[model samples]
Target chain A: MKELSLNILDIAQNSITAEADLVEITLNETETELELSIKDNGYGMSPEFLASVHDPFSTTRTTRKVGLGIPLLKLAAEQTGGHIELTSVQRSVDPENCGTEIKAFFRKDHLDFTPIGDIVSTVTTLIQGFPEVDYVFTHRICEAGSEKLVALDTREMRIILGDDVPLSDPMVLMWVRQTLEEQYAG
Target chain B: MKSLEELAKIRERMQNKVILREGQASTRVAVGMATCGIAAGARPVLNAFVEEVAKQNLSDKVTVSQTGCIGMCRFEPIVEVFEGDNERVTYVKVTPEMAKEIVEKHLKGGKPIAEYTIGAAEK
Candidate 1:
């Protein structure tokens, strides 16, 4: 992907296909490294599927053969001397915190690594598209060894609306977009 | 920065329509969103479709969704529109601006823009 946010959006779509009702995305950037993590409370993949998840052509969807999201993300990470980690757990009968988590670490200043582009738009689009799903997006700017955290939890906002209003409502979406912009901009 | 006041006004205006548009859409607008698509700038294309559909108040009739690679990585940022029972029309190398036009002409006007279709792109 040209931008890291685009990869995030694509991976977030995978979480949606997995029927995740709740998804969490985190971005942590420092002088040396940029870390991205997307966690979903969806139906997890099998051990066999997770083993070869890096293969671009091994896709479950019959519409097309190649699944470039994860494989590309892996390549992007490795280009910067970083790596990707994917972990999943199928939901149990009693229900543990079962889901999948994909994490990638890249060199923050690598010339070949894609820039972090339009993350506010990325997170908000997911929120707007999936009205019923809950998303928690956390962005931490670690500069000069200090950290600044910007966390957005849709569940909290939903509760504030008395659980009737969808987050996709125009005004609510506006609020969400503004909130993320302010976090990154400030 | 977009003002919340403006959005609040839209919220008031769209309150009824939002509720009315909750269901399966007759026209499914699927955007290619795999790695190649993203590399070719599909995120904004997808967002443009969503924004345009909302702008035209065609959310009930036109549904926008993302899909994986269609085995044509060369034609990244592809968009497919499936209307009723007719075969889908795949548009290749779509941009954010083209997304708006497609919505205006095809989704709302009931005619596909031939120049932007896969037939033109392939040939």
Candidate 2:
């Protein structure tokens, strides 16, 4: 992907397609490392499927013959003297409760590492495009001894909007996008 | 920063049109956005469809969404239109400009541009 946000967007879309009801994304950047994690409350994959998820040739999409999300992330993390891990429970037994977690780490100082893109774009796109699902995004930047946190929770928003008002409304969308951007920017 | 006042205006105007569900839509404009598709620049093409649908005021009738790989990585920026019980129209290697044309022609005018279809490309 062009940006880290795009990769986040890609993986989150994967969760949605897998019938996830809730998807959580967290990015933690410290002095020496950038750690990224995405978790979803959705039907999980089979062991056989999980084994091949990182294979660029094992994609399930009918529009194309290859999958790069897993492989690319793994490569990105490793290239920076870091690593990635994924775990998921079987989906059939507990589709709603079963889920997967993908975590990747990268050296913050790696020259070849991608920059975190406009995360606001990624979060807004997911929340607006799929209003039925709950999305939580957490961004933490750790430098020196202090940590700055910015978070967005769409589930909390649903309580306020109720069933009648959709969060995708133009005004709400504008707010969601800008609020996250401003927080991170500052 | 933009004022929240304008948001209130938008919310008022939207009424309940903001969140579009598939069942409520009559036409589905799907952009292929698998890894291969994204590598080939499907994002802009997909965004173009969404924006054009709104600009044309066809949001009520058309849903611009995405689908994973269609197994046609060679045709990375492929787009498909599905309506009624008719067969789908697959457009291969589409650009933003072509997306706009598809909106104007197929989505709005009820005619598929055959020249842009995969069949045409194959020929």
Candidate 3:
């Protein structure tokens, strides 16, 4: 992926495929470092599968022999003098706490650090594609002794929308885009 | 800044309209969004289709959704258009510009662009 946001989108797809009901994407940016964490309440992978997740050739997909999402993300972080961590608890192993979390750290000062682009687009696209699921997105940046935060939680919107209005409604999506843009602007 | 109050108003307005359209759409546009597809720039292509479908007021007839890899990484950024139960057209190596044409010419006009289909790409 050219942009870190694209990687975020790709990784989130894995959660969707695993049938996650709730997905949380958080970004913390400091003067010298950036961290991205994606957590999903889905049917997490088995230990054997998790062990091979870093290998591009090991994939849950039967269609192709390679899955590049995790590996590409690992490379992107490592290239920026950072690292990635992944943890999962399969539904079979722990039904009460079955999910996956991926955390990637990047050095902001590193020359190879990829830019986080169009995150607003990513959040909206995820909602539009899967209206049944809920998502929480938060981005925090701390610089020069100041901090700015932008956050959105779809669960609150759902309560107001009730079961009648879908989150994917075009009007709602337009509002979401505008709201996030305004937050980023401030 | 936009607030939740605005969303509440929208919800009130959409509630009645949504109840009437609670059925499957006639056409489905599936964009490949797997890792390979993203690496080859599928995001823009998917966004284009979504925007065009909404702009054309075809949202009720056509639903755009994302799909995993169809084992066609070589043909990254692919799109599949399914009409009803029988017809499905697979377009390979799609770009955002091509997405617009597909939406306008193929989707709205009821004629698939022959040149962009997998058959044409193979030939």
Query: Number of the top candidate by DockQ?
Result: 3
Candidate 2 off by > 4 Å: A46-52, A57-66, A91-97, A143-148, A167-172, B1-13, B16-24, B85-87, B109-111
Off by over 4 Å in 1: A92-94, A161-165, A169-171, B1-15, B23-26, B85-87
* Docking quality class, candidate 2: acceptable
DockQ of every candidate structure: 0.32, 0.27, 0.77
- lDDT tens readout by residue for model 3, A29-139: 999999999999999999889999999999878897888899999999999999999999998888889999999999989999999998998998899889899999999
lDDT of 2 at A81: 88
Looking at model 3, residue A22 earns an lDDT score of: 96
Query: Lowest summed-lDDT stretch of 10 residues in model 2 chain A?
Result: A162-171
Q: On residues B29-118, what C-alpha lDDT tens digit does candidate 3 reach at each position?
A: 999988888889898898899889989988888989988889878898999999997679999999999999999999899999999999
Per-candidate iRMS values, in order, are: 4.4, 3.7, 1.2
lDDT by residue for model 2 over A1-186, one digit each (tens)? 667777777888889888888999999999888999999988888888888898898876654567788888888788888888998986887754699899999897988787777677677667656778899889899999988888888876676565666776444766787777777677
Model 3, TM vs. native: 0.96
- Shift of residue A38 alpha carbon in model 2, Å: 0.6
Itemize residue pairs with steric clashes in candidate 3.
Answer: none
True contacts kept of 2: 0.20
* Candidate number that wins on TM-score, 1 or 3: 3
Give residue B107's error in model 1 in angstroms.
Answer: 3.0
TM per candidate: 0.84, 0.81, 0.96
Q: Per-residue error at B27 for model 3, in Å?
A: 0.6
lDDT of each: 0.83, 0.80, 0.91
Query: How many clashes in each structure?
Result: 0, 10, 0
